[model samples]
Target: MGALALVSAVGLAVDDRILVGVPIWAKPFKFSVSFVAYSLSLAWMLSLLPRGRRAGWWAGTVIAVASAVEMALITLQVVRGTQSHFNRATPFDDTVFQIMGGTVVVLWLGALVVSLLLLRARILDRAMAWTVRLSSLIALAGAAVGFLMVRPTPEQLATDDSPIVGAHGVGVPDGGPSMPVTGWATTGGDLRVAHFFGMHALQLLPLVLLVLAALAARSVRHPRFPLLARLADERVRLRLALTASAVYAAVFVLLTWQALRGQALSAPDGATLAGAGAIVLLGAAATTLSLRTPLP
Candidate 1:
């Protein structure tokens, strides 16, 4: 995956070709880097398993294979200077898209298996164990979010010869104005925003635990801020983990809701702000309660 990322980066620099309003190599470059992070995280999570290590490892292998296939097909499309996703311009193009979709399904199933194993296995830390389990399940849901694009949009349905069957954009075309680097639509709802955030819960939730532990360790010798020590407590960490996951899950839902309503992320309406404010307020309340909970 690392090598693929490097190659795609080189392609991005060397190739001036544009497809779907972005640099042709952009998708491959981003997907490769994402796969590198995902593969490494899953491998480490598998190592944390006590009894279900074998099952987790098997699932990890399946995910690795599926990721490789997906990346390969995406890179092939990049080389051909065509869109990899939702492209049904020709029979060959449709077949490529179908195969890519199949790989995604395989990848989701593999993650699901690992998630179930994590639910059954005990890890070194209580917080991280549950974080892994919950994040994995959420990540699976995030992966499923990609399926939303598979359904043909109204415009595509109206057009008799639409080359694409679906799109990432809700009210606008996929190749329209987008944010820098991320390529998210700037004028309309982009489902990729929700999908990206949701799929990364596995990385983000564990990061919350690490940050908490690091802060505790850094303040171990401090006379002030004695509450930092609570982060070292297993019970405290577990409660905080749950709190963070709840807020994270809520935010994911909010983004999905915003996109489905054809709202641009940067221009969220009153409803969007209300949903976000609710998430923040609730998260703050949950955090305070977690801190007040007795730790033994």
Candidate 2:
């Protein structure tokens, strides 16, 4: 996957063919980079299993293979100088789309299995155990946000013989004004915003915990008091984890809702801002409350 990312980078630099308002290699490049991170995170999570090691290993392997194949197909389409997603101009293109769709499903189901296994496996740090388990589940919800793009848009529906079925942009065409490198819609609601945000929880949540742990490592040496020890407290850590995950889930839902309503992430209306403010207010309140309330 890393090699693919490097190759895609070269393609991005040299290949000038533009598709979907971006370089032909841009999609595959992004996909390759994402798969590298995603595959590594899942592989690490699977390694934590004291149980289901074999099953988890095989599942991870299958996921890696599926992701690789999906990336390969995207690259192949780039070589053919055509779009990959939502492109049904030809029969082979449609088949490739279907195959990539199946790969996504496979990856999601494999993660589901690994998450279930993690819930049953024993990890030394109770907080980290929960973080790994719940993050995977949260990522599951995030990955699901992509389904919103698979359905035919109203324009597509209006035309019975439309070659393109759906689009990532809600109120605008896919190739319109987009964020610089991400290619996410800037002019209209984009489902990929939530989808990308949600999918990254698998890595980000664990990273947050690690950062907290690092802060906790320099515990106070005072005889009677330990200032940093609370950062490492199992109960405190668990409370923070649960609170953070809840907030993450809420934000994911809010993003999904905002996109569904044809709202851009960069330019939110009053309603969108209110929803976001509510999430921020609630998250802060919940974090404070979690610290105050004792965990059972």
Top model number, lDDT? 1
Task: Name model 2 segments beyond 4 Å from true.
Answer: 221-227
Q: Which sections of candidate 1 miss by over 4 Å?
A: none
Instruction: Specify the highest-TM-score model's number.
Output: 1
lDDT of 2 at 273: 87
Question: What lDDT score is found at residue 287 in candidate 1?
Answer: 90
**For each candidate, what TM-score against the reference?**
0.97, 0.95
Q: Candidate 1: lDDT over CA atoms?
A: 0.89
List per-prediction Cα lDDT, in the order shown.
Answer: 0.89, 0.86
In candidate 1, which residue pairs clash? Answer: none
Please write out the lDDT profile of model 1 over residues 1-296, one tens digit for every residue: 89988998999899999888899989988988888777877787888888877777788989999999999999998888899999999999999999999999999999999988889986878888889888888888888999998989999999998999999999999999999999999999999999999998988988998998887786677737768866767788899999999999999999999999998899999999999999999999989878788556
| Model 2 collision count | 0
